[model samples]
Target: MNLKDLLEEEKRVVINPLQDENPPLLVVITEGSTTLARALIYRILIDETFGPNQSIHFILYDSLNFLAFLESTAIEITACAPNLLEGISYSADSSIAFKDADVVFSIGRARGYEFTKNERRESFFEEYIHVAKIHGEAIERFSKKDVKIITLGYTAARIILQFAKSIPPENITALSLLTLKITAALIAAKANRHPSEVINLITWGVNGENSLPDYRYAKFRDGKFVEEEIKNDVWLKKNLIKGVRSASGRSWYSRSSAYALADHCKLLWNDTPKGEWTCMAIYSDNSYGVPTGIFFSFPVYCQNRKYKIVQGLDVSENLKKYMKETARIINEESSIALNAHR
Candidate 1:
């Protein structure tokens, strides 16, 4: 064989090693909140949620004030898992942090902004759009072409998808799993079961307030999957939505949100349990009457490290109206965010 062909074969072998062999190094970057990034770092290193054997390199990138915390986290990780802590780094430079990154968590408000509910919606988008643009540009220029960017907030994801140049829409997703966790946990409480036992609970439409907690396909397991009685329960139809809508306003939002973000990342890299699905705010393709180009939450199944939106489910008339309203808000939010980019 030619020398070039032999070298190409070697590269392929290194990139896609055999099943028993060590996989390629996974480089993960966290962009905004140091507190959230610190929590995720602990979960990954101490809990080993991504698998005890998987090698990971982490870069915590944020404002200059967070540099000290990032360094301390690196030390703690080194002490905890010397072998698994391949390397931990801190960066204030987006380009440096994003270089060769395989996965990124964009999980905070803009560094200088502390927004309140009383603020104008348009103003909120205008502020956060800068965060999206910065991360998007860095990802496009420095990160791997197919890097997975899991943003925390719907507005951030929408802004990135709308105006971020040269970044693939499929590569970006807003994590709606927090709402999923809240919904499942609440239903599990009513059913007197553990939250993990609640399966296929879909968080539809948007991420936070006004999101639809769909229980039609949800099931619970004792020893086997069974229809969740809570689905037909009056509390399920009424109180559940109120509970989910107020979860983000809770005092524990930062830490719990971090956990949810970590869990979503774990599911993205590993196979989700069979016969179940997860929800994420992914860019729409006109599915279920959601507008063609917005990031709306939908049920999805992950296989082979890719997610396919769950299809062929029944949508009730009431659900359709909710989706239509969500589409309108998403478009309005997108336009406001995009106008800031201009």
Candidate 2:
């Protein structure tokens, strides 16, 4: 479906169960790096979903850098700063904020960087696992009574897998089992309380077929949890790689390449024919049309507010290899991040 159609579907699902007394409130917690983009997107979505006068509150937690960005943008949204700490303190604060919340959007953890490689890696893992615990605790607390949460990032999965691998075989099995159980529990809680809420656990930067677990969560129905496989489109795959690599890299080259590529792709798309798909390559000689099952984005018409993926024109072998390689690098990085955190 097209962007409009997907949004319309979301609106239908969200608004159907509403009563005149309590209007739904969207609470968003975003990381510093993507806060600007997220804020822009949130503004568009909120305007579309609840109109201009509706109440929308944005909470920026553990994000001083993002606060500056938001201030510069001048988007009128309420903001909050939550105290972050190791162990149980973080979870307590999250639970208090989540109480009486209709929909909660959480963007994973944020921490300042260290200079050395060892320090950086250690810091990253420590922050990630702690954030996972906070996330799990929050879900366990609020989801029990029917509050819906859409957590961004595979923080829980990363933590569970890491903890499982580091300990003994018995601990591994126990932790792994607990991870699966918690996932099912959250899904069940959301579905049981608010049948219409879309409770998704998504991780950015993972691409290709291997990234399915990061973006797609299990669906709860009939008192059971079933895995739902969500395929990423070409645009999402490309942009996610660029975003992750740039954000993680130490040098300006990686970051600049990401921004340049995105701008170039956008320009290319504008020049291409309407309803046609095109994938651009920096290493290859030309752009190519995307194949079926190969996620891609194309200009498409949204009827009744639904967007659909459109196919692109055909290209050469070299371009295809480049695209595949780019996706491979992204998936590899994601795996590395997961393993390092574990």
Candidate 3:
């Protein structure tokens, strides 16, 4: 499929608010291994939904090794300079490559810190906050009207907390949720510059089971903020860790327990409705294997050209606990950020 094909009147499917606005350009910023995967998926989806000839701009940062790996793939992508973090130093021009972007997908953050395990949390918080501010500023500067911004990664709250300077678990979770809302607000503000323009913010992540003892459902929901939860019923053991092992071609037994727990929850919940949900799982045995619980985005569809959260059915006590712990981890990360700000 090509860009022209996607913009065709016949191939277009109007889902609510997302109308065929001349096959909007997609801009992606990514870090680490997932960058390649997301880039491939984005290209395939764009081609399938629009057409092959459509021009999509992908902005990647971090890990040149991974970039080389991605270059070997079938997806045709262009590389931009200075990297995401480095680009921050040149914020004035960060958006230059994204001048025509209609949709922006951002993933991961720079991970460079050598501190005690306890202090590692604090360092990560500071790093992400700095990353978000730079990225946010760039978006505000370069984005065109009617652009949709989708942010991947579950660390938004942690980053915010680092900016705010308080590490309470509750506060960190609140900040994370707030970051999502703020991201939406930022995009809307940019779109408002033009008449009749709209901005959509789609945030994605895994559904943490609620059956665990350390579950922080309230925090994950961002203080009772109703959001959609997409459930995957495939047994976790069967599907979850396969990606980890496959991605690195090695056994990551240390993370096997985490993967097992996450997978077990999948069996406990009913499957979310098809077409309403987007699901992804990984089985890798590497450093990446440990962060399985982080929430990430998947290509999704809604009544509008936008994406909505998938709502999951009621879960069991055991699964609920696991899910809660996942949420807690998310909250805990944010807490580190909060502490750093303080």
Q: Who wins the TM-score comparison? A: 1
Q: For model 1, how does the per-residue alpha-carbon lDDT over 1-342 read when each residue is reduced to its tens digit? A: 554443222110012122434553555546433566667767765656567787666776765556555566656555665355566666666667778887878865622111234543655545567767777777778888778888876667766665455678878877778888888888888778889888888988765567778887787755433343654566777788888877743535776777877788777778688887899888898888887777888998887667889899999999999989877777766666667667
Which stretches in model 2 have alpha-carbon errors above 4 Å?
Answer: 1-22, 30-50, 57-92, 99-105, 109-122, 125-133, 136-308, 312-316, 340-342
- In order, candidate lDDTs are 0.69, 0.32, 0.32
- The list of candidate 3 runs beyond 4 A from truth reads 1-53, 57-92, 98-100, 110-119, 122-125, 157-276, 280-301, 338-342
Residue 82, candidate 1: Cα error in Å is: 5.7
TM-score of 3: 0.42
Q: What TM-score would each prediction reach against the true structure?
A: 0.85, 0.35, 0.42
Model 2 local distance difference test score: 0.32
Looking at candidate 3, the ten consecutive residues that score lowest on lDDT are 82-91
**Model 2 lDDT per residue over 1-342, tens place:** 554433222110011232234343444333423543344333333333333333333333323334345343323232211111000101113444344444333445432111133543666655755665554445455433333333323333333333323321111000011122223344444334342232222221222222211213324323233333223354234643344334433222322222322222223323333322222211111224322221121222222212222234343475456546544453343355556534
Write down the worst ten-residue block by lDDT for model 1: 7-16
Candidate ranking (lDDT, best to worst): 1, 3, 2
